[model samples]
Target: MAGEITETGELYSPYVGLVYTFNLIVGTGALTMPKAFAAAGWLVSLVLLVFLGFMSFVTTTFVVEAMAAANAQLRWRRLQNPKEEEDDDSSTASDSDVLQDNYGQAEKLPILSVQRRGSPNLFEITDRVEMGQMASMFFNKVGVNLFYFCIIIYLYGDLAIYAAAVPFSLMQVTCSAASNDSCLVEADSKYNDTDVCWGPVRRVDAYRLYLAVFTLLLGPFTFFDVQKTKYLQILTSLMRWVAFATMIVLALGRIGRGHGEGHPPLADLSGVRNLFGVCVYSFMCQHSLPSLLTPVASKRHLTRLVLLDYALVLTFYSLLSFTAIFCFRGDSLLDMYTLNFARCDVVGLAAVRLFLGLFPVFTISTNFPIIAVTLRNNWKALFHREGGTYPWAVDRVVFPAMALVPPVLVAFCTHDLESLVGITGAYAGTGIQYVIPAFLVYHCRRDTQLALGPGALNKHRSPFHHTFWVASVLLWALFCCFFVTANIVLSETQL
Candidate 1:
């Protein structure tokens, strides 16, 4: 029971947990936000970002509450059926059996005949139950399938964006200024795909070449185990923070020097559609909350911790984005915001220019394998049969290929990182971040009340416990989908 896979992550202090959660929330999404901010204008982007951040926070509480409910359910089952015995053989499956199926027998803790003198809270989140396992416990078969479907779509989008971003960054840096002495720096000019990168090689061709290299380097890891080691995490986090600081300082310096090229409109509804997706993606730490929050030695102030982290992240995003929009024209902002500094005219130091240009490559390279392996494993779980092992080829070749192929092909056809991020966040992000959590908390609360007698209350229940909150989340998701879809249709018709 102690060595169970479900509880494998290392425990840490509450502050360390705070840092991990913050790092998780702010990643590639933050890097793309400046372009979104510029296009959407200052006031509209600010209002939407604040609203969405609050919504994301509400759902984060929902996930935490569900986790407590999941633990409470497990505890009740353990009390009711200690030895994994079936209470009713005639029934298709007992609740205890279902819990065991979702969270293996290794999770079956030995019940204490008498309660300890000072026991923990009734629904203390002691066990680290994953989102998928929680889904299996609380959702019907179809709901379970839908859960996996949304996650797969989200991961596919994530990989496609990554595939396009790294190669694009490499091309931008090498061709623009980092390695090319004769590189021309046009004021506020945005390059096209047909532009030459090196000699006769086109920018698009250079991107593809680098994409192949990235695939060859990281693709093999999907076929094998690639642990995200502690050292690797530390190195990547360090690089990310440093890069963010450098970009912010550079932008602020340019604005201070009165060399700002930006004169953005106060409002631009045409850009609102993409900005919605970008904001949603930027605040996406909900999916990973179980692993992120479970290890804290104390969760007494967990909600407060999450709120503080969100506030800090929101402020940081504003500084980074506002500085960028003021320092550079909207037309000049690249999909990956850091690439804007690659030109010698924008950033004087060659080393700083190269570092900013290649920042995505360095950080994204480390994350690509971890995400690929996770997607591959998710595929295996989705199709896994009870009491059966996969054939060698299916496990090794088919599953990995299924996980890796679609995204690569999408990246091949279009290197439009903004559209990739927008589409991914708009559809799949809404499902995972809003719709899923709403249903999860709603069902989980009912399951907990049924499992632990009618009187038993979840100690960690969300502050927004009223049924109204769940309904509101679903309604918001519907509105976002309608708005984004209508915007897309209108744009196509205008074109």
Candidate 2:
């Protein structure tokens, strides 16, 4: 991909990028949100959800702003050493011919072109830098390692959740007692490991069996390079929209027919811990912003496009969760909201029930290998030296195993998707979502100004450019950490 494409009519427009970003953020978290919302109570959930969404948006701009800074930094280094310019960086803009090779050898020029308030802007965002590369650029070795640790932990939690959920859905739908069309079983929340799935097999055994199949099927992709086929993304996107629409309409339809069973409290502090994590998990799109935003040919209105996407996502989450908590009782809600409708009675049509039951299978099955591959690559990156290559065995076997084993082990131990999301989002998600970006933007700002002189402006800088916002983000992350730790300690003590 071209590193810099400031002019229009190139790859894709900002509008298309908006849709891709929306899809990225609105994944598994949305499916798990209603249960958290119900437990937390509507008033508290709504207020926290809105605040979390706003904070997420703020950090998203930080990611974008950092991306532009990464570009500028790469471009400056390239101009300094034109020979080794394209060695690691991609900011080899064709405009390097503007100055002679020894131009800045004696007395330095502006690291990047100087930008005086209304002078024609020349400090173009000339490269696409991944977050890891950005961390390496701005952070010390310890900070870089911390960033990788947070990301790896978050992805592991994601894989474990997926590993548990797909099989759990299969276990729910295939149980002979539950699946028989003759019996009108209500979507019950009392399911457990001891429940009978088939004549002799218990639900727990069936779940493990399906988990084995899922691992055998998708786990191999971690060992090889898996490029997401265009058709696969399209198919999954279609099924996802269909699944979400069906759930929302079914919930709305049930509430309309005087079958509404929900009566959640307006405020409840007991569930706030899970609710905060759920909201953070739901609004996550910061890490992948580089891949999504870089290919957009024109970034003039990129921030506006992102704003529109977040607004739409916030509205959609509110609709999905609000309808959900009101249409189903808090006590009866499942960890996976979609599972609540995976029954003949809840959804009138047999086809719809089948589709809803297998929705995670379709969408998440496709996503597993991609995430596995990504995690595997990240593990390799964390250990890589400046001029080093791993042996074939370590590269192929060790890295993939490192990526695949821990999450599977976690899944084997527990299928509690709620706690999995809560723990992951509250801690690792805090670093990636709040802490990392705040520090990245803050450091990148200092580095950029030092290089380009104070007058050098990054046109794509975040609106929350003030130092106060960065400090506030850091403080909020600290509060979440303390609050979640206290709750966990209290619960354990009680137990």
lDDT of 2 at 482: 95
lDDT (C-alpha) at residue 28 in model 2? 92
Model 2 agreement with the true structure over 344-448: per-residue lDDT tens digits? 667777777778877888899998988888788778767766457789999999999999989888887888888888888999899999999999999888877
> Ten consecutive residues with minimal summed lDDT in candidate 1?
99-108
Each candidate structure's count of clashing pairs: 0, 0
lDDT of candidates 1 onward, in order: 0.81, 0.79
- For model 1, residues 1-495, the per-residue Cα lDDT tens digits are 112233435667778888999999999999889999999999999999999999999999999999987777666656567666343221323222322212221222332233222123657887767788788778877887788888889989999999999988887776665335844233444788898877898888998998898898889888886767889999999999999999999989999999998988889999999999999988998878877787777788888889899999999999999999999999999899888887778888878877888889999999888788778877766776655678999988998899788888888888888888888899999999999999999988776655554566666778899999999999999999899999999999999
Angstrom error at residue 102, model 2: 36
- Model 1, residue pairs in steric clash: none
For each candidate, give its TM-score against the true structure: 0.91, 0.91
